[model samples]
Target: MDEAKRVEEGLAGDGQTQLIKEDCQGDLHKKLDRNDGGDRVEDAPEQPMAETAEEQLQVVKQKSKRVATLDAFRGLTIVVMILVDDAGGAYARIDHSPWNGCTLADFVMPFFLFIVGVAIALALKKIPRIKDAIKKIVIRTLKLLFWGILLQGGYSHAPVDLSYGVDMKHIRWCGILQRIALVYFIVALIETLTAKRRPILLEPGHLSIFTAYRWQWMGGFIAFVIYMVTTYALYVPDWSFVAHDQDVPRRYAVKCGMRGHLGPACNAVSYIDRQVWGINHLYSMPVWQRLKACTLSSPNAGPFREDAPTWCLAPFEPEGLLSTISAILSGTIGIHYGHVLIHFKGHSERLKQWVSMGLCLLIIAIILHFTDAIPINKQLYSFSYVCFTAGAAGIVFSAFYIVIDVWGLRMPFLFLEWIGMNAMLVFVMAAQGIFAAFINGWYYKDPQNNLVYWIQKHIFINVWHSERLGTLLYVIFAEIVFWGVVSGVLHKLGIYWKL
Candidate 1:
């Protein structure tokens, strides 16, 4: 008999309804199926079509094991984030961006956002049921937003005041959480509304906004245009109808009119945010204003500004806003590429190589572009910045996909994978005061002493005082120890925090 008929016969002839039911029930199924005279027939074992499909599915699932290459790449990014963030040294040595140029540290956040997009694609593939997929996405997005907001609260270091008269003054409007929330919402909305279909390759449905690739390309284009147009219009008015020399603060003052006078030297964006979204909303702060406070000489700088009433009113900073756009593009680009990977499977190697080489050429072109009109500023997230950094990320990701997935190389350092699994959580812990407090109290002479200072003095200065190598080693060691503790616990508990 055919496979379908055999399956039908087995189902009909089996006195084994209860017997087979009992056999296949619960987690003891394999052992039960092994029992004699249970559901077995006297002839050759019947192969049911349903069983065949299930077995094939199981095989596919097994073959699609988590890509270690991606995990390792993610692990490397997380480790770098910890190192640069925790470094207790001068900003110059830590590879920060120049006023209008990219730096080694510039890649961290975009890498993170890109990985998130990749994971979203992978996750949707794993979810067999649409209802469950939607539920999971919603919950995960909420968790990420919640955690991000909680992290922002760390900087506030005070209770959220909800009283009258600029009670919003103490609350920050834009922050790490705000950015995460925006990205998560946009990506999740796209995935859900499109029913998790590969936008570029899949046939258009009622929900299809556009092909996934098209959407991503459009987003990137729009972001680049908005950044350039808005900055030029506001700052360099000669190029546009808007007035020239409308520095951010002055422009903000003009827009606010009477209300502007009430606030201190907040950025114009902050005032706009307040007008549009209410003062209580996050990101109401101006961007440049915040950066000025953090970096150089501001009226609020030093001891006086530290305790000023409007001390918390720092501007949002350009990099901070531009980073949002970059982040969105990063995810969109990853999603588009993921669709390409899924639909055009066999040509992966060729495609990967092509993308890598193309990106390298693109990077060179961007560098040339930077030499003239567009400087590569991380703060502004200039077009050249996006081109250069995205190109670099593409090359890196291509290498990872090739080595880990294609070559089937196992990770030598399992600990890195562990760290990568709970990357966002690890970042929050380090970014907040958790690890910093512990290190200061346990290792440093003073609780207020920075970790880098301790390493420089004790590990570097005392032990190997003459060498820069000692400091570097100490930095690496400290990061490993911190990540080991964080990732170790996550691994032990089998807790993979996703968002």
Candidate 2:
């Protein structure tokens, strides 16, 4: 994900909720496809027949099982997403880092993407036909992109006409879901290319966890190297950096890269956006404002004099083209976790590998940050930022995996699992202000206007005396409860959103 405005985001799973099916004689059985590499699980418990197909499906699912760990991880990520996105305006840590650094907010999308990678491995692990997998991938990618576009207040805000509706003059092309769609598509494509359908151990013929990890790790490393090289050595900008009338040395450009050149006009990622979409086509919020050069009345006025900042003024999206590259890398890290889950047998071995990967990435991130060779910038999706977020996500999900999957502790997190199962739907609804729409639609004018304001003013603000904390709590409760109820119903009905 990118900046708060272009706003960064997270991923999805392999869609195989119907892994358990009814045999012809009405017996429950888990069908392990020979092509994708799913292990055969015990049959689902028998259920009473229902009159309709939908009801039967619901009944069947009620007795079936799933990878509880994945659901819980996803659930946790979406829960955090709701909390952050709902009241981020009141909390700095929940919104994206202003320009650089990691926050709880930054991990939401990457964690989701990580779940998606794992799900992809799980769902497609048993697919026999690569063509079929490809088809599904294409369809899911399009749907994600569609949701991404719609959430931009595109179709949601009426007219939708060139003249009246969405301000086409500044329609954002890149966004959370759009980036998700692209990342999933690319990652899925990578899976497809590397996938081998040759039978082994009389089981399915699909990309082995071992093979997939190697391909992803190798490709990710190569892509990162190329990304760094182009950004550093080859991106010859028309303008050169100078301070104290001293032109910046090439060594700094090769060493420091984008950190040294934060000008609105500089950086390969922002430059690509300007070239492809121009300023108007990208996101517009807290629009970049360039101050006119002026002499500081006092040298101590700020960290630097008025002349120190870059002069170019244009709001470039954080989730633009190049940052998407880094995002996919985060997803790559997730797929590696996916492999560990699938193939690694020993618990100690699994935990060791998982924590080891996290540590490696963290060490790399620390090195980059301490040396100032690069900064951990979520806005730019810097290498350090990607690695840092991925490492944190891995450790966090690993913990969830232990508690829920291994320990079999389920009751406390069932509500979150419900949210996780329908994560994309919840995010879309929240992002488009659907919760506000319904709540506001049922107007409760109690001195305070909207539902959010009314609830907080009465139940929270009156008690806390802190406007920010109270308002934040109000949003979280309203949105979470609303989505929780909706997802609960959907879950009970055996409905889910998946790609």
Poorest stretch of ten by lDDT in candidate 2 = 1-10
Off by over 4 Å in 1: 1-60, 125-138, 154-168, 196-212, 234-323, 347-361, 364-368, 431-433, 438-457, 466-471, 485-493
Which whole-number lDDT from 0 to 100 does residue 410 have in model 2?
Answer: 82
1-499: candidate 1 lDDT, tens digit per residue: 1111111100011011222233333223242111122112112243332344345333222223344544566677777766665452323345444344555667776666666665555434323345755665566556655665555633433112211233444444445555655665566456655554444244545223234445555655676666555444433111101212236532222222232121233333333444444444443333223234333543122232453333234333432554466567666655554444444434463355338543864666476565666666555455566566666766777776666556766555466666665665566555454554444544345544655555667776578755455655655676666676667687777655444
Task: Give lDDT per model, in order.
Answer: 0.48, 0.61
Q: How do all models score by TM-score?
A: 0.65, 0.76
Best by lDDT: 2
Residue 204, model 2, lDDT: 27
